[model samples]
Target: MRVRVDDASAGQRIDNFLVRVCKGVPKSHVYRILRSGEVRVNSRRVDQTYRLQLDDEVRIPPIRLAEKAAEPVVPFGKPFDIVFEDEALLVLDKPAGLAVHGGSGVSFGVIEQLRRQRPEAKFLELVHRLDRETSGLLIVAKKRSALTVLHDMMREGKVRKRYLTLVAGRWLNPMQHVKLALHKYLTEGGERRVSVNSEGKPAHSIVRLLKRWQSYSLVEVELKTGRTHQIRVHLSHLGFPLCGDDKYGDFSLNKQLEKQGFKRMFLHAAKLAFHHPLTDQLIELEAPLPPELERHVVQVEQTEEKEYG
Candidate 1:
């Protein structure tokens, strides 16, 4: 069967395009078709990496759908808070402890739930990502045109992302720039982890100290390069691991903070700004710190005063 790529589908990899259009097909089978040249773009056999263009004709071979037992039911997810919405985009205030999209043993996440709730939406895709434990503003694209434009803005350094985090140590620098090369590797347990290494992808984060207590500092982090665990790894390498960060954090401090009612990682995506993809209007959005995080900050302040007084 022939399928025509539209503006929204343009720029997506051929393999991803196939997976989305061909529901209930195993990923292994999708790659097999591509390798066998049964999947063609514009009458030419292209690799999975081919970025589809507008109006490109995709040839899909017949494939049997997985049996009902093979396809597990995706549980319904309650809708998250909507920070902003329009024809082209949706901004959500994602809470901590919810995965943005499910994979790696997670059954359902924000995107799946949103799609389930808005079954009539012709297109809905995550413009960017957030860690499962990180709470804050997240962007979802409603149109393919908007997704393409937003990606361009991010590449050109036009997107501004700011995060708030409380770390385990007193950060001495009022303003510090961290340019560390990071390498990702899986632990023996098969879990993903990143660390500072000489031979790795370059990463940058600008940290501005906001407040300090006896043993912790609240800081605002601006990402210059988006890398996996960039903020968490950078802070940890600098001896200021984020409070309650299970991975690359101070375990003793995390336990102490938990006992104090600070139960989750103290990292939050607080602000996002960019030019509207379709309108070219400057857009700035903010997600207020959740009550739990805000209250922890206040608790830290009270402790600081008590100690200094």
Candidate 2:
């Protein structure tokens, strides 16, 4: 494969840049190629740590794969909401109750449907992920180059995501940060959950209260680490669970919400901000609350007003 460093990635390390550009190629093999001169920059062999300058031409030999690229293993459907799309990437507004990828007995998800929509697409990859119950902007890469770049950006904590949720308690503090350590473990049902632990991975979230009511509060959360259930578990542990969070909320309240037509969780991925993998330009994306969630919010507000009045 041949690649040229563009202006956006002018000052990155050569190996780092290469890793971003040559995704799905194993890291060990990538380094081996770099060490053995199979990979070259400007036609000269360089170490993995070599700093990359703008306009550097890199040449890499074809990799011998132990197995051919697999066929589409995921099943397909037709209900996909795309927010943005280009040759290099696609941004989707995934709805609540839909998984991003198939797992734990799920036959298909958003990615599967997307694959079916564009079967000829090569190197389609998920840049970041959202939980099955969380809905909003999801980034999908159409090429290996874009995938590698976006994944690197995610690892470096450059991707910014914001979620809007209705929590169970009244939050008087409009601006507050929720810092907690999260430990992940699988349940007997093979579902993932998190808990506060001293030896767990460090997780931080900045939560801002957007609105308040007698029984629930609408808040915006910014998660620093991509830990599973970090927001739900942390906020639950903090004594204010989400309004419709069945897994981490009062059972009676959840039952009440169910009666109120809240059929799904109230969490929503409201926005996404990241850098364009190919152009290095900043990208900001948004997804509005769906009808169900919107109605639930209005109902909760009305109920709260009645109780307080």
Candidate 3:
């Protein structure tokens, strides 16, 4: 991918800037390309630490991203619940059981299906990611220019996301905040686990109890840091794992949820706030709770109220 340095990216190191702009580029491969002269700034081969100047033209040879591959052709015509879209980006309500991009035994994903619809579109990129089992709003960039703009917004911490979830305990407080340090690693069994390690990265989640039931609570969450599974991991560590979270939750609760016709994780990305990639207008998108989650929670809450009263 060829890149031109602009005033916004001025005075940044060549390697650092490239890694930020090019998604999924490994550190080693980035340096390898720089050393091998595959990357040129101002038509000259520079070291990895080369400091970029304003308006410097860069020539970047096509480099493969080892972590991501060309999306396979698998049912690319599947319909999507589009929330908002323009020439620069697409906002869609990604349902549970839909994979954002192909991986982890999912042969075809939302991106693949989108590509099939617009064959002439190039650089269809995801601004943020959502786990396959989790449902909610997702943003996809229609052009590379818009991709960079949206990414910069996220990196600068300007983008905001809100989630709604039902956790395994009755919370009566108006607001509950979890400030915990998270250390993540692959367990001996090759599954990911998070613990409250003092040496871990600092993480914080502001949770507010919107309602309570006999054995569950509906909470709204805001993320201060975008760690992997930050909300789920932190909540689980706090001993209130999300309902139907099979990986880090109670097995019996999961079974009960399944019996209630809940087959996927009980989580949703309910809202998104960010600047329009092309128009620079402040944009906010919202998706109401899916019927399954709404009805399930309502029933649970009503039963709990009657029993407790």
Candidate with top TM-score is: 1
Model 2: pairs clashing at backbone N, Cα or C within 3 Å: none
What TM-score does candidate 1 reach? Answer: 0.87
lDDT tens per residue, model 1, 110-221? 9988988898897999988999999999999999889988988877778899999998878888999999999999999999999899999998899999988887899999
Estimated TM-score per prediction? 0.87, 0.76, 0.77
* Alpha carbon lDDT at 47, candidate 3: 95
- RMSD to the native, candidate 2? 5.7
Best by lDDT: 1
Q: What is the lDDT of candidate 2?
A: 0.82
- The lowest-lDDT stretch of 10 consecutive residues in candidate 2 is 70-79
Model 3 regions more than 4 Å off: 1-72
Candidate 2, residue 29: the lDDT equals 84
- Clashes found in each candidate (C-alpha, N, C closer than 3 A): 1, 0, 0
Off by over 4 Å in 1: 1-7, 10-15, 26-61, 66-70
- CA displacement after TM-score superposition, residue 251 of candidate 2 (Å): 1.9
